[model samples]
Target: MRDIIEPEFEIDEKGRVLCKTHSNFEFFSQPKVNRYQQRELEKQLTCETCSHFFNDDCFFPRSEVNMIEYDRKKRNAFKCKLCGNKIDRMLTVMHKLYYKEKYNIELPLICCTCYETLKDGKFIESSKWRSNMFLYNALYAIYSLISVLFFILVYQVRIYYLLVFLLPIIYLFYQNMKKRKEIKEGMRYYQKYFIDSNNNNIR
Candidate 1:
């Protein structure tokens, strides 16, 4: 006789289970597209300055909207021929598919233009402190090395004299800290801008 065992639990990407089964197997649906992909598609489909597809002259034939009335058009009104869904929503769906097929990444919803832009560029240019930190640390190390050499050659100072060379090190440290703080603030500002831009684009 075959043994019968009850199912343990269900699995899902967002933790919301859809069903339970008699077998001891689990299933999970895919996750949504990511913000990076969405941002990329937005860049591809819309004008960087205005987040619309066309300009005053309607230079791009593929654009769905005329530049003049682009702002007045509702997002839900523009339908995709392939999916019969809103153009923006269709873009998000396509982006998710593309991300899965191309990069093997299960991303959240992303607009068409943002996906294109990210695919073309590979990644966004968000500010980070690592670069600044590297620069400051490199400079400080170089200056410290030079000061140690000078002390040894001119004053014949012992290796302990290296401790006295920390004046420049402290100064550079302060500058690096300040610069890192500024970069962090700038990152927050840009993050806010990204969120605001996404909200406006959806509307």
Candidate 2:
């Protein structure tokens, strides 16, 4: 006679593997791992209807097998899992590092979909404001030059015209300080928002 080994419990829709036996039956759950990698995987796996694929907050397999396969294919060439867009992970990493150094912040590893969304949303606003500030400063410099000519023209009137000329210079200095503060604040807000939003999405 042959003995039979039965599974203790049924595998749920959440990708949990259950062990079932005659003597003892219990549900076996996967363990937690690095969240950064997990978030990247979440963005990649787009099929929501698949029962085998559950959200990370619920019980699910860590997909080690898939990860190994992905790594192998990535070494050769693989498409972005989310959008089916071809991407080079190494080049992506280098580009990310370049931007991080340029922007002075650590950007979370993200796929093209998320990156594009973020760029369109927050980055565009910051860049626009920065550009406006530059334009304002340039205009201020031109105005200062015009004011100097006005001072020269009016110099024969009285020494008071010289004091009047100093007013615009002082105002320009104040505007420069204010613009600098605004830039610093804008950058801080953007960096904080980026970090917080990505962290929340991952968690």
Candidate 3:
């Protein structure tokens, strides 16, 4: 079995849930898509029975992915340069660091699995700090201790003060649980995409 880490999704500055492994395609790695080039790639890719067909238009004749089917469909969607799978997600490969246009050109739609394998399982970006359970646990411990001390030393008469003190911790715990549930749901979507009916990994 291939040992896989549970993929972590980071909330970007734009509030998008993005995978951790992000990278630029190598400088000379862009694909050529004329008939002759497609023929060449097809011979090498036929072992996997996958298509390496490319077009300037979108790869999917009709895709359920909105950004792919609509926004980027005509202009940016193309065959994945790596495995030749239908482009599902595009990775920003080129850009000006100092200029406003952060991503000038995006690579073909390379799925997350291929991206991970190509990068040798190194995540380029990370937000695991947001979900560090130990940190939350420590905060919970400290909060509980402080609440008990405050109740005993300051507000002993009204038991309601303890509930008031504990409300923020309760809300924090709720938010943590909600985020964990969301992550689990996201992982399920990835598993669905990668696993096929024959139990073979498609990506």
Which candidate gets the maximum lDDT versus the true structure? 2
* Tens digit per residue, CA lDDT, model 2, 1-203: 33322222333333222333212121123333577744553343321222333332212233732453465356534433222334433324333333455567664344454345455676446445654775578577667867776777867566566577767776776766555554455445546665677777633
- Model 2 TM: 0.29
Q: Model 2, residue 70: displacement in angstroms?
A: 59
| Per-residue alpha-carbon lDDT of candidate 3 for residues 1-203, written as tens digits (9 for 90 to 100) | 43322222333332222333222111113354477864543333211121211211222212223343343446644543333334442222111111223335332344444455535633212113323563476467567857676766775556666666566766666666655443344344435553354477564
Deviation of model 1 at 152, angstroms: 8.9
State model 2's lDDT. 0.45
lDDT (Cα atoms) of all candidates against the true structure? 0.42, 0.45, 0.38
What are the RMSDs of all candidates, in order? 20.5, 19.5, 17.4
TM-score of every model? 0.26, 0.29, 0.31
Which rank order by TM-score, best down to worst? 3, 2, 1
Candidate 1's C-alpha runs over 4 A off are 1-126, 129-164, 200-203
- Tell me how far the alpha carbon of residue 50 in candidate 3 is from the true structure, in angstroms, after superposition: 37
Best by TM-score: 3
Model 1: lDDT to the true structure: 0.42
RMSD of 2: 19.5
lDDT of 1 by residue, 70-177 (tens): 522454444322212234433334334445655698644333333343356421342343436646775776777786778788987786767677666767766666
Candidate 3 residue-wise lDDT at 143: 74
Q: What's the CA RMSD of model 3 in angstroms?
A: 17.4
